[model samples]
Target: MQKRKHWNLGAKLAVAAAPFALLALLSISLTLWVSWQLDGGAAAVNEAGRMRMQAYRMSLLVAAGERTLLPDARSEFERSLALLSHGDPERPLFMPRDEDIRSRFDAVGQHWRQYSKHWLDVRPADNRGLREETARFTGRIDALVAGIEAHMSRWTALLNLMQLATMALAVIGATVLLYIGYLFVLEPVGQLKQALERIQQGDLGTRVERNSSDEFGTLADGFNDMADQIQAMYRNLEAKVSAKTAELQEKRERLEALYEVTSLIATARSLEELARGFVGYVARAVHADGVALRWSDEANRRYVLIASQGLPAYMTDGERCLRADECHCGAPNAPPFARVIPIQALEKEGLQYCSEAGFETLVSVPVRLKDRLMGEVDLFFHAEVDLSPSARSLLEALATHLASGMENLRLNALQHEAAVSQERNFLANELHDSIAQSLAFMKMQVEMMRTSLSAHDETGTRAVLDELDAGLRESTGDVRELLLHFRTRTNSEDIEAALQATLRKFEHQSGVRTTLTLREQGLPLPPDLQIQVLHIVQEALSNVRKHARAGHVWLDVQQQPQWRIEVRDDGRGFETGDGPPDETHVGLHIMQERAARIGARIEVFSTPGKGTSVVLTLPASDPTLLDLPPLQAVS
Candidate 1:
């Protein structure tokens, strides 16, 4: 097939209109030529008629015997004849080229020449019937006029025929133009419209046919290219949307796993429970077949399996304890990053148990807290599995959470141990200062009583016996006081209630009238601090019972402007020479030690024959109390 030529819309339209334009121009040119030729026909006819009129006028002048008029009329007749012979171009008078008309014109001119000469001969013989002669010449003039009229009539008919032919050609040209427009413009536009409709209706596969190398063809090619791009973009968009949805789903799973592990950490009472729950959740989240959690020593040498979600019983037992240098799974010293290693890549001795279980892939994630390598988590897969960055990150996050949970449990255990040890020490101190000191004094008194008995001093022995009996009673009371202090527990909600209970018990045991005055002004002290304060108050009360010998003891507690407590006794008081507390005043020392533990100050005021008052003042800005955790069980 021959390649077609390309033309734009303007060129196509111009080509379609060119033939009609030429035909119209030719038609108009033909009409103007015919009209121009006929334009002088009327003038020629009028001039010929004027010649006949001049001939008749000349004859009449001759008949009138007016010789002067005859010459003038004769000259006028000649002038007309001359004008007819050579037509006036400026006046637009043109003689017809028809042979009949030309012959008749010549006859008219020849007859007039002969007739004019005879009429002017000046001889009567030359003159015949003037009318008859003039009439004969005028008849020839009439023939010429008739010939001109006949020629003009034929040209007018030919002009009408030419106009009719032009109209027919114009109709044919318009019909052809309409057909071309339908083929080139309307049909192509229709096809393009249908293709656009298909695309708009969601059929991205629609394409236009490129049948011609024209504007429509270019348009078709462009449309096809655009459709290709749109279809490609649509496909790409669908892929992107699918990938995004999958990414969001993966993220959601990770978040859920994190939340489950976080809840486990918060609620689990032991590291084992937290690790078990963490491994189980991680295995499910990442679609792993088996998961194991391990803990290593500070030096990262020994690994102890803390928890496992899935594994053979034998494999779990055999791999329960492995060193970092011997195990392929929990090698914390190898690298800090989580990695997916093929089970077969490991040495047979390191992970032969995993390979024997038909596991193909293993992912080891390190659990770290700060800079210390805590342990590693191992995930086993039955089939080969590739971990994306997101998946690996999720596993690492779970490991980090596990590390934090384990560390928190460890810290809590240490804190509990420390608290227990401190309580034990406090009890020991209380025993040594009170009961132990009392026992040592009784021992010395027994020695003195023995010495008196050996001397046979009856008064000294009786006195020593009374003193020993008093010492025994005092020791019994101290034992009971120690027992009360050991069993004492403070109320967390209200310290006043615990203080009231202590005072009631003290008044009942010792028969010493006790009064408690409490004034609260600010937020209550923390439970730990309150417990220490209550213990100090108890110690002071114990001293009042043993040594003060007061009738009434008053305990005052103030919470405002700093925690302040005072134990006042109206009893015979000993002198306090402030160098250090008397070695025997172990109660005062114990009270001061208890006060110092909670950032409080203690003061003892006593005078001979006057009362004694023990005061405990806590600083307003005691930062140590804020960090003290809730008091643990005393035991």
Candidate 2:
């Protein structure tokens, strides 16, 4: 099998991590952006402050040159002038970028050039020009210092505001992220956990209702699927118990019912009591709100309500009869099949019998044999009920049991009856799908052969003869298989022995060393299902004998989640594809058909020159269906 892609734990974690990842990214980017904004004003303000310091140094050097005549001070003053003229003295290659600070330095340079020209000749009389220029420069220097200070104060205020805003943004983003985590992550997960706890406590109906197209939704779907499977398991286990209980109880009841009905009919006393008793049993067994037995009087073109249990006033109107057209029992001309049907709202008022009792559904079971509908037991339900497949099957079986009871009543009227007639009816349906179809094919072949023989067409006649031979052989094989099925009725307890016998027969016929392994402790299948399984195994082995030409074959029956049966052979295998069934591999159709009837899955694996294996898996909860082989020969 190819690997299928699934969103696993890692994917779920990734989905959960998305919000936090976004939050981290937001915090880091916001901090960097805010820090960058605050730092923007600092460079210009720092540059302005540095230029003011250079101006102060130049003023001190001019004062020293005017007062004490320090040569070093003059030299340093000239160096400071050169440094300020260019920009940063420590790194003279660079120029200042702050426009305000650079413009103040330009004013300082203009004043210094005039002050230096005058102070270069420092005479007492010309000291007036120097002092005047010095005063003006000093005033400009004060204003420059104040401007730099004011710029620093404004930058500090803006930085503080930005930091506050950034902190608020950070808090808001974190809070939003926390809220998102709580709403989308923590809360949903908590709900899911609580649901799981409830499920662990045996609440199978608990659901995690995630309505998003995200991981949570997928998880919800998975949970629901698991719940469904677990619920199915519970139902299957319950049904199995019911089946076992019913198998014991129903068998006893059926026998008792048959005997009592036989005695009642034989005595020719109180058929109404019998009918009423049987209807009541059915109503209680199937949990119906009410039940009524209605006898069909086709001769009078009406059906008369005969007996009832738990019925209300509106249904029979103190005993009533209905026309053929008004009958909702079944197809008038067909055999009665027990069916569960819902009450339609539109037809509610018209159905007087159902209207008063307030039933949502009904199971109409005709006490019938074929189209001879003697009467019907209608089971009404006041509310809807979830009917499992097995329950429905059990109800159907009970209906048939009732029909058989009614038929026995009639049969008792006559002193003697032909057993072969009942057997014939069963054979008719079985053969219709199998032997009857083959016979129809044979008839066509025979017709063609006759035409060819009449035309004196030797080649056509010979081919038709060959075809007839093959068809006859297939029909014969079918008969033989049916004979084996009818004669050997395998039960759960007898399956091991039945299989051993089958294997011995195969070994004798094919000269292949056949081995049988029964590994389910002992096959624990329901008795009614054992025969079908036995038939499938028999057909598979028969196929191996006819086609495989193998030296050995292995038969294994085991349980692995379900019952598994494998028939493998070490023989040359054929290519497989959809086409016509090959003559070499006989009984394949019969095996597949039987598996299908039992709701079992069957697979055939083979490779050319390698080997062939047939595997069948039968589920425990599989419902029984009508798979009666033509056990009687056609008359």
Candidate 3:
């Protein structure tokens, strides 16, 4: 459809005032014309009255026999008649166009001509007759003046009438203009304002009416279009906000479930505890009817149920263990990614447990760490379950946590076993170095004594017996020292206090004077490091008592940029090519192993006669010891 043509605001206002404008122009034109006509009217009356005086003067001049003065009077009277006929525009003098005024003016002119010719020019013998003619002439002049005055009065009245009519039309035009403005501009503007207010008050449906083909009409259409767009945008915004709110709520639930599972992983001590907690939380998180967690062997040949929730007793017992081909849930043929399986489909493959238990669907999430599929989490539901991508991802994340927890527990068990084996080897080394060597020497001495008895040498036999007694006494001391070392414990955390106690015990037992000097200047060692240091000190002390044969021993500990401990004895020292071999002195070997465990170095210094010193030096910063690996058993 073609659009209708419309005037803009400026055009509309101009059109409305057109008639009044024209009326004003017409009234002004008429007033100017009437005033121009009246302008000359007074001058005509004055000129005519002067002519009457001139006519009376001529009659006087004729009667006085003054011919020269009479000529001047006649010229003056005739000039007045010409002025009244032609009108003097400069003096603003003019005769009216009315025929009565014209005729009266002409009669005055004719009377003046006759009186001048007969009485003044010809000198009439009777002065009374000339005076009478002059009198009639003046009367004619009076009538002409009256005619001019009447004409001016009528023009003036018409001017007043034009002005009054103009004013009345102006008032009417203004009233009509105001009415039109209200209908087109003010009323439409007010409607738009009301609609805007309603829209502000949340009423999106408000609109304006298009009442005319003008600016106001265009404005009304725009307003309605704007309202429509706003309403549509508002509706779309509400929908998006609702969708976001629901998404946020779902994420919050997932986070809560993950937190619960994390707490279980942190505090749980065994795989059983972790799996049980995990299945319960997973069932609640995914709204499943039942959940089962299972572990797969390295060959992927069998599955073992670790924990289960909301499962029937019969189903749990029957499916407690499954070979690779026994059940689809535990089968190696299942895909690595998390999946949904129907119980009826499983039943078609000869797995009747789920169908018998009335489960319609099963969600099996593979528990994996990197590429290793360690286990599976099976969720059972009576109704078929459709999981969203986020829900599926959440399930997979829970499976990963389960896998990590299981792996951690396995590593912990392996570390405990290794520690036990390491301790056992240490005991064997100690016994072999000390007690076993002493027993071998005693056995050889017993053989020497029997040989001497057979030879019947009294001095040799007596000396062999003395030697055997000494060997027995030395072996007894070794056994007691081994027992002491084995039973030793670091009851206090303070390394200084533990060392002090060890020194006092060594002095009392071995009957040796000992001095302990500790100079501390750095942070205390970690408990594991401290234990290793203390054990090395005790072993050094044990060696001193058994072999040093010293009168006094000094144990010095310095804690600073590095930790250093020196066990020095004033004993008949052993000869050193680098020091005694570890095979011969097992205490030295044990101390070296303990030092290596804490990332420390051990050194032995000895002289044939002066003394022997065993020094253990540990660096303050040992990155290898920061995250120490599990101790490997050594024999």
Candidate 4:
């Protein structure tokens, strides 16, 4: 069944007023009706009394034989009687309550008419007959008067009853009005004040007892429902705020950890060191029991454990290296992200690495550089861990950072290796160009001397022996100069000072007038590049002294838009095709190789019987940037 809605304020007021209104209306209507009845009865009684006066006047006039007065009185009495029987415009006859009053009015009207007819026929001469007629008419008028008197009395009694009814109705109206005021207005107002006080006291649980079906009841219920909803909302909002604050705090910690890890990785000098820092910091940041990193040693075809921390020694002792099919690191079937696994699950799958290592959970992330997988990092936990998506994303980012940093370190190391290899090749070429050529010349001279001795030409043998001695001394001097070149450093002076020193040494050694020009002053190069430049300059000067057969050389180091090194000689220059199999041209080739290693270009300009110029020009390199691996191949 459907329940009715509570009455609104207007409806409550109307309900309270309705009974009073109805009683008041009934009382007013009864009183008005009773007063109307009394007025009609009193008017009829007055007309009857007036008719009695006119009837007495008519009798006096007839006894005096005044015919004119007789007609006037008779007409007036008859008119009053007619009006009582029927109705007049001014005073209409009343409808009686019963047949007795109506019949009395009819009898008075009939007797008066009969008396009027007889009095009109008889005359002033028949006084006795007139007197008899008057007596009979007077008697009827008296009866009529009595009836009017009784009618007035009855109407008066009815008016009194109506007055009592009015009083009773008024009493009912007053009682109902008082009850309405108490229940609807006064009582509800008191309850509302109590409700307000409770609300002011912060008691949201306060609820009014809904006893009446009115607006106040609805108001109380509404307030209660609103309070409940508000309280629930407040609680829910508080919980959400607390949870959000916790989440933000956690994010702040993670960000701080990442910042520290980034700084550590940046300063780490080697891949192993970087991996150790990365794993340690990541484990501490996200809270893990242990971390182990493995790198693939491709040349050895095995995984080498590069970094391990917070793990049992037994796990890393003999297990530092793993073959392809022996580890659970997706060696052949690589997953894209870190694979989280329970130790029990791994044990079930016959992968006992985590289980034997005494870890309950294991997570492995494969380090990659683009398409190639480099290694895998394994994270272990002593307790169960459910990886959230956010956690997994953070782990993936960490893995990416490790892989990129390690790869950069490896590349740097490889660059150093290449630099060393290049230097070795250059030195071997230098040996062939200077010392080896001298030795070959000595061997040829001895062979020639032996041929002369066999033919008995002593002059030819003596000349060849002299040449051989000079060659030995020149080779010895070349070796000493090579040692000096190694000792030249910029610790005490800049490149310009070093260049001037090298020119002075060349002038002393070869008796060549060496001059150096600076195109842009304060030209700078890194220590390693400076060493390479010095060695190349030494080789060029040695060539000028030993083979150019000239007296002067010029060294021009310039910075236009970039750096350029030029060594010029005013001596006999070799042709492009002079050295067979590139043997005599080996010095030029080695210079070009050195230039190429440092991302520079070497240009050789020469004409036979004129001069030779070797120039290495490099793009402008920023001195402020820290670039590439350590180069120590100047030897």
Best by lDDT: 1
When 1 and 3 are scored with lDDT, the better candidate is 1
TM-score order, best first, reads 3, 1, 4, 2
Task: Give the per-residue lDDT digits (tens) of candidate 3, residues 1-635.
Answer: 99877788778888887877888788888878778788888778788778877777777777788888876776777777778888888777788789999888778778766766777667566776665776787888888888888888888888788778878877887898899788767888888899999999999999887877778888889999999999999989989999999899889889989999988888899877888889888988888899999899998787889899999999999999888777768767677778888776553764578888999998888888888878789899999878899999999888888888888888888888877787677778777877788788778878888888888888988987887787788778767766665565555556787788788889888999999898866666655566567778888888887788899999988887678899999998877785653346447877887788777899999986788999999876842355554443332
Candidate 3 lDDT for residue 245: 100
RMSD of each: 10.2, 26.3, 9.2, 12.4
Per-residue error for 11 in candidate 1, Å, reads 9.6
- Model 1 global lDDT (CA atoms, 0 to 1): 0.83
Error of 2 at 616 (Å): 0.7
Q: After superposition, how far is residue 180 of candidate 4 from its true place, in Å?
A: 22
Q: Could you tell which candidate, 1 or 4, scores higher by TM-score?
A: 1
Candidate 3 stretches with Cα past 4 Å from truth are 1-194, 202-246, 345-347, 439-527, 547-553, 559-561, 569-586, 596-600, 606-611, 619-628, 631-635
* Pairs with backbone N, CA or C atoms under 3 Å apart (clashes), candidate 1: none
Candidate 4 lDDT over 1-635, as tens digits, reads 89887677788778778877877787788778767776776777778778878887877876777777776777787788667766553554554465676777677778777776666646634667766777777777677667767777877787788788778878877887778788777887787779779877877666677777667777778877877886787779988999999889878867877787678768889766787788888887778899888887654257788888888887787668887657565363567787887776554643465687778888888777777778888888988898888778778777777778887788887888887886666667767766788798889888998999999998888898898889889789978876686577876426888888988988888788988888875546777777777877877777677677787798988776677888899888878556412255246676676677667787777788888888877757763242534555463
What lDDT does model 4 reach? Answer: 0.75
Tell me the tens digit of each residue's lDDT in model 1 across 245-360.
99899899889999999999999898778888888899889989999888888777888988898898888999988976786776665677788888876566754888889898
lDDT of each: 0.83, 0.65, 0.81, 0.75
Candidate 2 local lDDT, 421-450, one digit each (tens): 544553454456457777888899999999
